[model samples]
Target: MTTSPRRPMMISAGVMAVMAVVSLGGLVFDDRILLGAPIWLKPFKFALSIGIYFLTWGWLSSLLTVRQRLVARVSAVVIGLLGVEYAILITQVIRGRASHFNVSTTFDRLLYLIMGGSIAVIWTGTLVLTVLLFHTPIADTASRLAIRWGALISLIGIGLGGLMLVPTSQQRASAVHQVIGAHSVGVPDGGPVMAVTGWSTTGGDLRIPHFAGMHALQVLPLLAMLLGFLARRFPRLRPDRTRGRLTAIATAAYAGLVALVTWQAERGQPFIHPDGLTLSAFGLLAAATLGAATLVIARGPAGTTVPEPARHTEMAR
Candidate 1:
């Protein structure tokens, strides 16, 4: 009844912290393998990711100046849905069954549907919080841009998860299995994979972009923080406007990266095995980002613009 926006989310994050530790232990001690990796691996990764996400939202909730009651209600709903998701995932892991994309039995299908539905609702809840941020004023320009753009991009990232739900051509072709979806493209799920990520090595893996995009919530804000810290040493970065411009550039670049990886994955290309076209596209993106960043730094502070020369010499002309 107190309407404290941060408490529930932070508490949820704390629970995830404990779960992460337990899941890590399970990874080491338990010999059970789900799909291709250790059964506990998915739980461990999800625990860490969800913990960080909730913690970020917990902090952001404090920044909201208006609509305390509404914020609290949304926060509660998001947390509750996350709990549902984790419960099903953990249960499946314990039972030595796949939590995601698994419809091997009636029970499995029901659980998967519940998990998917919960995630959709959770994404919608986060979107409402993000829209609220636009109305809530923050004094710092860099931080404001970081939070807004980060949240928007994070929504895009979260939306990408839905892409995995679509059945691949192979899945459609094979009538022998009940599994409906997969993270990997151009190859089956239980093939050779990367280390702890379990991303397919022989084909495209949507998780690469999904992971990169989702973490923009952390990355963009951290960039703003880093710029703030460096401003103490370098006066060029001392201006709020300059810092804001830099943050905006970084945000665009980060979004571009998410797009690039998503494009690469859709083409059935392994991240480590990029062909010429992918490399060329990435090169262009990097060059543009660096060029824009340099221009921003050269502009100096907010109020002061770079001066034009009074007279043009022959060489200058």
Candidate 2:
């Protein structure tokens, strides 16, 4: 079998995917509820998320050329740490206990602390990987920018999880503090929620922005792929610089989206119930993104000359 840098992460991702499927099955048969959602729902979500996360990182790590050994080691550690965190989360879920922010028992608190610590280390490892990515050279401008911006934005998204750790005013004011943090603002955790996602409909939910930001790792790269595909049909999309610029604009717009949602959540506004000001902000962001995209397309090559895509040297397994 041909060993590759992507192998381990891909394996990890597959395991998570299987776990997600199992968790989904549990949802149907377990008939358990926690924090106003099905008990297995959190496990299912985490499993799916971890699967995708590992998958993305697998592809990403395959692209690295510099410091191969170091990157692999760091990635291995991050993946292992995530495994530990997920184990704890699933254990809590199976026990019908809240995985996050639960301080009901000393054992639960210790498990929560371990989860937090593991993720902190994982985040730091990801930072190292990001730095290594910056140092690695890629000939393709569009792909390069996509990878860089995607990684940086993902870090921002992951960092937002920290906000959920802060004790809400309600948690602080209550005489008996069972939970330290909350996912919702302007309302308690267990309340009227949106379908499937369980995001609070009555108040702002931090997970919305956090989810959007973290997935940039895939979104930006997919955008680059989409542009590449479109280039065959449109001569104006032929230029590499044009695609790179477009990716930059998209990254900025996406970052703006993250900021906008974060701001909205902080203001205690539900995502579904955005006020006029929020709408205005969104409109502005949309307009600017559209304008920038238009300008890039207009300035792109009028000729249908497709240049060979830049090739990145893959790291050794």
Candidate 3:
């Protein structure tokens, strides 16, 4: 496939545009008719956003093969998950149960499973895709090695995220929180403390666990950047390093911020601690580990180089 550099940018822009519009619409109709519009409509907006995100991936995958194909496959899994979620939501709407977000009932539990499973699939697929997509095309063996190590660290972050999903009692609570203006689990003290005082069910705090896991996005990507940077700086590594070091630094900083936020949430306690301090602490540790791992990857030795599959390799022999 012909890779068009501009196509990815365009698709990204389009997704951003749609997200902006939806956000604006939500803001404009705050607490008004639009805000209270049929519950089904609300989820659709999110579904549309997810759809756009997946479409962007599809377009990007079409641009190049091999690494791009890996991305496309991962994206397909994410899209499939989103599609199932959309269907379930549509069913809820048709049944006039759109307001139900808790998984107290069998149907709700099934919905939660679908959502959580899909998200997990997307997270794992994304990590694999990133490794294949970001390897340095022009580099010494060391730089290529750094890329592999970086990818490995990122996978660790992904694994940590999946682990967090093991405790998913608050899926419904999270959904209701979205419907209402509730505070997220583990938010730091300072603002008006909001709690899930009345959720569809009473169980665990899904929000905190999910957010903690999602922080891997920054953690893993930053580690990748660090690897890329080390490969460039060391003579034995790659010669033409682009934004590797800078991205690594930025990602490390972002991970720190995520940790701080997680800490704050822990301190805030009762308000953010739907599952209590113990769970929140677990999240904090995970985020901190990700940050620490990023630093380590940044400073680690550049490993072995892997060849970038040829363009024709993406198509046929």
Candidate 4:
């Protein structure tokens, strides 16, 4: 197996991790507001998440045998663009202003443009990498599911974030009044929060689904692998069959959860304040998933008996 080009990614992760820590340090000293949250806070958190994301994906991507040149090119370009995005976000932090959803001044708009373009490049690179990954002969079924599902689910998260970028009625008003493309749907982005994540408690926050969906890349694969490990521990169990079914079950549950959060947000409901309808929907999903799992588990892997060659001899004799 070709040793993955790991050094470059290791370096990138190290640098970004340092930056995230530094950004955290900046929060204590720099007192500025971009929306209601501290300017440095958003960038600091984003750096932390994106840094981890890159590192995790880097390790996972190494599992496959994509063209070294293709991997290098995509990694370089994506990492570079992400760095630029971090730079712009940090720049806004220092300026004591909004980075995303900002259209107040011409310069702010230009910064938003650059940030958007940079993200577009990064996402495009991610898509390209996903396509490349599909063609490769990933060793295990569990890993194949992880690579394919992770790439697809992560893109959905990206799409949710893109949806947040569009100007809604409230966002349009906010754009004219303060910033453009607010993440909150019914209310402004900076509205009352639930302490952490800055997701609005007072009204709809589009970030909830976006956040949930984004991490599928990490979660689904881990779940699948864990199931595989557990199956191996059980001597009677078939690892391949169990892993596939478990992965399918997990993916369905995960997708339902993401969609549920999106639905909850769209209705201007906070994460904690899901009404009867939400509960009902969730119950239905749970029941369906349970039913599917029950059937798959009971059926197990099909057992085919190979016809003995001795039958022919017996018949002739």
Q: Across residues 31-144, which tens digit of lDDT does each residue of candidate 1 receive?
A: 998778889999999999999999999988888877888889999999999999999999998899998999989999999999999999999999999999888877667888
- In candidate 1, stretches whose alpha carbon ends up further than 4 angstroms from where it belongs are 301-317
Candidate 1: the clashing residue pairs are none
**Residue-wise lDDT of candidate 3 within 227-250, one digit each (tens)?**
445654553333223234434444
Error of 3 at 114 (Å): 1.8
What are the per-model C-alpha RMSD values against the true structure? Answer: 7.5, 2.4, 9.7, 7.7
Specify the poorest-scoring 10-residue window by lDDT in model 2: 308-317
Candidate 4, pairs of clashing residues: none
Location of the lowest summed lDDT over 10 successive residues in candidate 3: 308-317
State the lDDT at 160 in candidate 1.
95
Name the 10 consecutive residues with the lowest summed lDDT in model 1: 308-317
lDDT by residue for model 2 over 177-237, one digit each (tens)? 7899999998989888887788899999999888988999989888887877777778777
Tens digit per residue, CA lDDT, model 4, 1-317: 43454566777788888987888888887776666876677877787778777876677567546687777787888878888888888887778877887888999999999988988888888888778778876545555676578778887887788877877775455425446566776776776777648788778788899989888888877766565555544532344555566677778788899999999988878887789999999999999888988787677754422234311111011
Q: Write down the TM-score of every candidate.
A: 0.93, 0.95, 0.46, 0.87
The candidate that wins on TM-score is 2
Q: Judging by lDDT against the true structure, name the best candidate.
A: 1
Q: How well does candidate 2 match the true structure in TM-score terms?
A: 0.95
- Give candidate 3's TM-score: 0.46
What is the descending TM-score order?
2, 1, 4, 3
